[model samples]
Target chain A: MALRFALMIDPLAADQTAPDLATTFTAVDPAAPALTVGELSTQRGDGIFESIGVVGGHPQEVEAHLERLVHSARLCDLPEPNVAQWRAAVAIAASECGEGEGVVKLILSRGVEHGPTPTAWATAATAADFSLARTEGIRVVTLDRGYAIDAPARAPWLLLGAKTLSYAVNMAALREAHRRDADDAVFLSSDGFVLEAPTASLILQRGDTFITPAPNGAILHGTTQLSLFEHLAARGFETAYETIPVDELRRADAAWLVSSVRLAAPIRQLDGADLTVDAEFTASLNDYLLSPRD
Target chain B: MALRFALMIDPLAADQTAPDLATTFTAVDPAAPALTVGELSTQRGDGIFESIGVVGGHPQEVEAHLERLVHSARLCDLPEPNVAQWRAAVAIAASECGEGEGVVKLILSRGVEHGPTPTAWATAATAADFSLARTEGIRVVTLDRGYAIDAPARAPWLLLGAKTLSYAVNMAALREAHRRDADDAVFLSSDGFVLEAPTASLILQRGDTFITPAPNGAILHGTTQLSLFEHLAARGFETAYETIPVDELRRADAAWLVSSVRLAAPIRQLDGADLTVDAEFTASLNDYLLSPRD
Candidate 1:
């Protein structure tokens, strides 16, 4: 027998709307027949997923996000979800959702298949109350632990580049950060290089040049980060992608964690070090990020 | 409602009859109700699991296997399981199963909440007919992927040693290998050092010594490879845990991959070179590994 339960979406609809959260798609559509929750979990670690904010009811960076999804599928050898099917799912989900700047989480996972078979499944959902924009600056902690820098690279067998659902570790890291009474943990290499945060992109400023890790396999090829890179270049901000050691991070003029949801969050403190970087950096980036691109 | 499934026994029963798999603690009976699957998957990836061969109603490495299950839990920060409960589950599953040396996997993932909030959870189970072990050898394609070699040491904030259910990357790497028409892929660093095999232990033979990557946070601490090291040591063979560069691997006498299921599979060919190392080294290791430790 299939399991059934009421999805409490009513409470979420009654909220101030935020423009960043555009409804691109949703997995739990009202009109479509629902699937058993167990079935959803049993499908192999399905591929990876991303939660991007939509602007003006439009999925931000749709093409680039889809490209990453396709790349992740190829890397994991998962079957590519049909583009039309995905577009329809997103439309259906967006049509029924209520309220504000909600989240658009795109999950490209494995389809229902057992054994050594190629299966790729993609699902999108609009999450309520998952605003990346926060009122207060984040208290960040730095932790040392990793064999190598898990940055993104152009490698054929790179999983860090693909957003697969084996997110137990990622979620656990967040929980670990919470245990320490911090917002998030920064993953540093054994050699003490500032890598990406758990789910967000790393953006730091060295002089007038903004720097992020290169698109290596050690890190996820974030869509927002990529978008920001292009926008920064267009706005005449000096930008470069290079390896940044942990010590250099301490000397950074400013730092912020970027992601689709929390477009760019100011880094107030690093491991309790008082960061006196320009708070205006965040404001400027946010202004540009939220403004509609012609 | 709880999902009900029939339990079978035979090979599991045979292993249980030995009393070796029984918990040594007199205070707490080895056989007791443990934790649920969801808790284990969420918490510390703690659990005792075995992919064994059940030939003619007997399970392979029943004692050593069970002992390893306990060891894995301890190493990964998990609690001791009710061995009796595990044995009972295994026995029931084995009895009703078909004939032949099918795979039997026992997992002690998470356990019952021990009163106050525990730092970790525990669980265990067994399964038959796992496919990871049957392949003669894996054809590994290398990826210049940079993993934090000291990810654990650098990130005390992250649980590097835990074997949580977040195995998407590991599984994804296998799929990548399959896509490349290779059996498996060895994750490489930007510096060209062989970091690990997604699901198995890294083994490189230089002259007479068999060297594996150290048990750093970068890779899973493999139980089978550790057993082989002891076996190799007993025979005056030099087995060391050290960092191996990918360039050095290309010139090594041979290379092999070890895991719970694959045991020890020689790298017959890497890229395109035929190492032909399996005929002797893999067979010798297999012979020693398959032999009774006592």
Candidate 2:
């Protein structure tokens, strides 16, 4: 229960008297709460975040997560985050977690209402074990995402590419999946293109090629998925980025949901029909995904 | 700057020792902040909210706002809010604002990440003046909302009709409008059907009929629009709800963005082209809208 939390407020703001990262991180109490109601993130969900896995006090894919967070901030029109501040905060949080394994959340918000600058924070907590999901795989159902594949190009205001904090709909989709006695959900575009899972990126294999939906401004640029593709390419495995049809999932030889925390979880069932899952291949992908990148 | 704020935690939660309405209301410091970091609202945008106009310490259209809140809660799968508690809190917050007009925001969130019950609060601040928007009117640009008009029926996970706190996209749309030198935005569905504005409902007059986009599950139910329709009916004006095309807006007699606080602000221009305005009719409608409903 000894979770680590640290907040970094705008130093230039006259009313903010909180200590800087060095002292604050060192003195953070495990039981103390770290947010205020006036924050734009809490009030309007106007922010961006990254959830990086922490192993043995080191953040996994720190650079990749930071790059994605910055990209997300740009999409939301947020001020550029202080990368050094985020790095320091994450290191402190991860170290304080003193870990076998944990989850480090990097949150950069649009600051308080009408206040100048942004609010940044890092929190470290025990990571949820996904051993069963990795080995036994997951059952998923398809749900309409209510938008066409070209939505991102047609509407930038949609903020489709950003990994924003406005994830209520995503969470609701997962809840709906659970309500239907399923483990997860695969969202399909209104025009019948496979999009992604509620919390993870979709990966499907037809033969030797590991395929995923192209970024196309419709999906978040998945760091974990990108890392896996790089590893697969180096090992002479074919990979692709394309507009995947929902029917392609049914015809797929294997499918998986890939993310930072869960790594690669194969699809055991699509809808109610059992799909052929390559357990050995899935185990190999997890090994590549979980391995620390230089 | 003396704004009134109060927090309400579930009484059944043993850890929450905060006093109920009476003592908490009397002791509230206007300057004190009312939220903490653990709240799911700030973290995940998992909540619903209502903003009611308080005129001379009396909340306008209380029943309508509360009823809408209930509907929104049902959509988000949140527990039934304690209506009596909300009423008491609103009364206290309103009373604390003296005889001046103010804005009262009622927020009900999914509570803390690990906590059991929901978190609810009401905050009252001086109302923002919209005299210019009311008299001079506003210029609007149409933006694609990235979903088809019938999307809500096909996808409940979209939370289309619910006024949840996950309004980053809405806020972004407004910002995009401002960037284009427009005062507001009227969101169009991907299929080019007129929907509604980010924060307000659209009402346009065609011939003798007051036509607004029907609540086809793609837009939030507008309390102000509903109240106006009732008042219009009483005054012998014809009203109708139907699927509105963007082209129809160009041919309309007059259009307005109606909301609780702003009341009714006429649209003077659509995408830079000046539109006809019935100032006399708009003023008359505002009179009806501002009048207390039984």
Candidate 3:
């Protein structure tokens, strides 16, 4: 699927007297240019973003995504985003988009040089069919993230927790995975612990219980993983966030790379080591992820 | 100082049958937008850039900057930039820019998703006056870059040497320096070696000799510093690149952070420790840096 819809959100339109936020969430032609060349989003990647998975015209976990957006803004030292304003924009984008699986992205840039206000916008795109991976599973290779898990707390300037637009390293890791003939990658900390994947969270399972790398300052607190854990706990299964060692990955009975759009992809192989796959369980998790949660 | 000129360069226009590269670069309104929300440059900070210093209507070190741009593109797995087309665009930008001191920024983004061509542009802005820092000098602080020196060699995917647009961490480092009451920050390798500043290169002076962190696959080979070394060597000053230890910074007779637009700023203070400033020597070096150099 291609892009289903796009909207240019006016983050500073609250003071306007226009009803229905008529000026706040305006429609934008998705194909046209909508950003200045000077935007720090492009110049310095000085921004934060959020991508909410939308299914059947229902945007999932709007509150959680918005909360994470604010969390990211705080970590990046950006001005706090107005959650109410953004929630409204996501609604408009979801309703306008095709009623199939999709994603809604919100961006808050530091705006143009010397400009008074920050640049804000939201765009919606229909997600590509992830049917094959969701069922067939994906092979993953472990790459070194080169940072000790403790690096984040020692140097907040690294912006480790913030989901800023500085994703070149992440993108590079993905390319390396493809070059290695793997479908995805899992990053390992320099101190010999398992970190998250480039764009998703890493979870290892044994029997019925599941364990994911704890949300240390170095790893992103994955939204999808959090929701999945809740779902798992409700189903009477044990779930946990633990500091997983490199050798522990080999000991796992099963594993997965989970995210909002891709839902859950069972890790069939890890650095040449094989893991068991529960096709029925993985399918049920995908079903839970694709439904509107909030 | 304000933005003086902007040009959108078509990197794929070689097939056009036009003269003066007229169809290649078109002047853009500095105040208007020129990018789409879907562009990877803004979405993922997926691009490379070069900033050339312009003095008295001459773009200094154009070749070096462009060469570095190509180097960065290759490191980031981006398409090799068309240097000839970029040089022409830079010339046009410099000619239209104001005299005195300024900067011309060149950006080559991965472009909009699913688009055939890459998005490229150049913009000129009059530089902010650095009279105080150039003469009076600046205070410095050291921050951890969180990567071991050997890590870069081990993991090319980290893109340590690439001048990528994913600069959120650099921006955060600068902000951290400000909060610490310092004028700038130098990144220290996790293994106790000096790296470089957020946007400038670090050079330590002792007696009449100077040393900068070697371009050892972990640091950007600073273009301005390279030019200054050539100039200094001509003046009978010994210049070398070495793996300087952290303690070596405190033992230096003097030090400076050098870059294109900022030229050279002597270090007056480092982490609250004082250092001597050589006004006459610094000014002459700036004079050399300001002149058109290829």
**Among these predicted structures, which one has the highest TM-score?**
3
Q: What is the lDDT of residue A109 in candidate 1?
A: 38
DockQ of every model listed?
A: 0.19, 0.55, 0.75
**Candidate that would win on lDDT:** 3
Name the best candidate (by DockQ).
3
A161-203 per-residue lDDT for model 1 (tens digits):
6776665456556767777777887777656777788888888
The best-first sequence of candidates by TM-score reads: 3, 2, 1
Clashing pairs in 3: none
Interface RMSD, one decimal, each candidate: 10.1, 2.7, 1.3
User: How displaced is residue B58 in candidate 2, in Å?
Assistant: 1.1
lDDT ranking, high to low: 3, 2, 1
lDDT of 2 by residue, B1-294 (tens): 224554544523322234554443333343444555556787788898998877777887888888888999999999876665667667777675556567778888887676644777677777777878888899999999999998999899899999898989999999999999999999999988999999999999987789899998899899889999988888888999999999999889899999988889999999999988788888888777666553
lDDT value for model 1: 0.55
Which residue ranges in model 2 land beyond 4 Å of their true spot? Answer: A1-3, A9-33, B1-3, B9-33
Tens digits of per-residue lDDT, candidate 1, B187-236, equal 87556667777767778888789899876665666667777888878888
Encode model 3's per-residue lDDT on A1-294: one tens digit a residue.
355567877776754334566567667777777777888999998899888888998998888888989999998888888777888889888876586788888899977888746788888888888988989999999999999988998998898888899898999999999999999999998888999999999888978888999887898888899899999999999998889998999889989899878889999988887788889999999999987798
